[model samples]
Target: MAGLFISFEGIDGSGKSTQAKQLARALEQAGHEVVLTREPGGSQGAEEIRSLVLEGDPDRWSAETELLLFTAARRDHLERLIHPALAADKIVICDRFADSTRIYQGTRSGDLRNMVDQLHDLVIGREPDLTFLIDMDPDTGLSRAKGRGGTEERFEDFGADLQHKMRAGFLELAQQFSDRIRVIDGTRDIDTVAADVLRIAREAVGVAKSDA
Candidate 1:
C-alpha cells in the first residue's frame, strides 16, 4: 500500500514476463528497492500450487477448481512477499496477477466472470497500482509461447482459438479498468516496448529520468 504495485499482463508469449523483469532491474539500478515476483508462484507455497495448476493437462482441473487453487496461491504470495515489500516502501513488480485468472479461468470455458469477481473481491482484494497490458496478435503470441517447449504448456496447449478470445477479453478488461491499465503495443521490438514500459513506470512511481 505504501509502495508502488505494478503488474505486467498479456496473452501468453506477449513478452510481458520479459518486460516485468526489465522494469524491476531498471528500477533497482536506479536505487530503488524492488521485489520482482510472479503470481501463483511468488512464495514457496504458491510455487507448489503453480506446478499443480500450470503443468498438468489443460482439462486436468475444472475452471472452478483452478480458480480456488489460484486464489490460494495468490493469498499466500501476498501474505509472504507482496505485502511486506510494499509495507517497506519497495516497488513490487509482478509478472502476472489476478487479471490472468480473470481471463484464463473466468471466461475461457464459460461465463464465470461473475464468480471470478466475487472470489477476487472476497479473498484477494488488492490490485496493482499500475498495470502494463502487452497487446499482441493471438496467432503470433501462441506461436511464440509454444516454441518455448516446456512442461507448462497447459495454457499454451489451449490452442490459438483460446488465445484470440483471451486477447479480446484482456482488451475489454483494459477498457473496464482504464485508469490503471496501460495498453502497450507488444508487436514492436523488445527495446522499444521496454522503453515505453519504463517511461510509464517511472511516471507512475514519480521517478524522474535525471534521477535514473
Candidate 2:
C-alpha cells in the first residue's frame, strides 16, 4: 500500500486516543490526508456491535463470544473504513487494533492468545506499518479511565490487577514486534506525549513513502 497505517495501543486511559487525534491534526497540517478511527466502532455496523460488546453485564458474553463480536466489528471496520482509506493512499491512524484483542481477551480468557493470532491472520491479515503502545502505570490508567465515566465500562471494570496484566502483555507484544511497534511513556504531559508521537509517526510516514 502507498499509505501509512498506524495503530495506537495501550490499556485504557493511556492517552492513546489523544495522541492519535493530535497526530492526525499534525499530519493534516503537513499536507497529508489522514483517517483517524477506532476499533470496535469505526464503521456503522461495527459501532452498533460495539454497544453490544461493551455494555451490559461483564459476563453478558463469554470470552469466546466476546472475541467473536470483536472480530466481526473489526472485519466491518476494515472493509468499510480502514481498507478503503489505505487504498486511497490516506494515512490511517487507528486508536486501537488487533493488539487490544490479543491483550484484552488473552488476559481475561487465559490461553487464548494463539486463537487471537490465528483469527487475526485468517480475517484481517494486515498489520499496521507502525504501532504506538502508550506505556503507563496501571493505577494512573485506571484512575484516568474511571474519570472518563462512560457506559463502556465493561473493560474498565476489570480493575487494577487486570490492567497490570494488560500492561505486561502490551509490553511483551511491543518487544515481539519491536521493528514495527514503538513504546512511548504515556505518563508525561499531554503535549510532551504528543510531541513524541508526532516524531515517531513522521518517521513512519516518511518510511512508508520511501517504501512506496
Candidate maximizing lDDT: 1
Assess each prediction's global lDDT (C-alpha) against the native.
0.92, 0.91
TM-score of 2: 0.98
For residues 95-153, write the lDDT of model 2, one tens digit per residue: 99999999988668767888888998999898999999999999999999989987998
Q: What is the TM-score of each candidate against the true structure?
A: 0.96, 0.98
| lDDT digits (tens) for residues 120-209 of candidate 1 | 999989999899999999999999999999898899988999999999999999999999999999999999999999999989888422
Q: What's the lDDT of the predicted structure labeled candidate 2?
A: 0.91
Native-to-model Cα distance after best TM-score fit, residue 191 in candidate 2, in Å: 0.8
lDDT of 2 at 17: 91
For every candidate in turn, the CA RMSD to the true structure comes to 2.6, 0.9
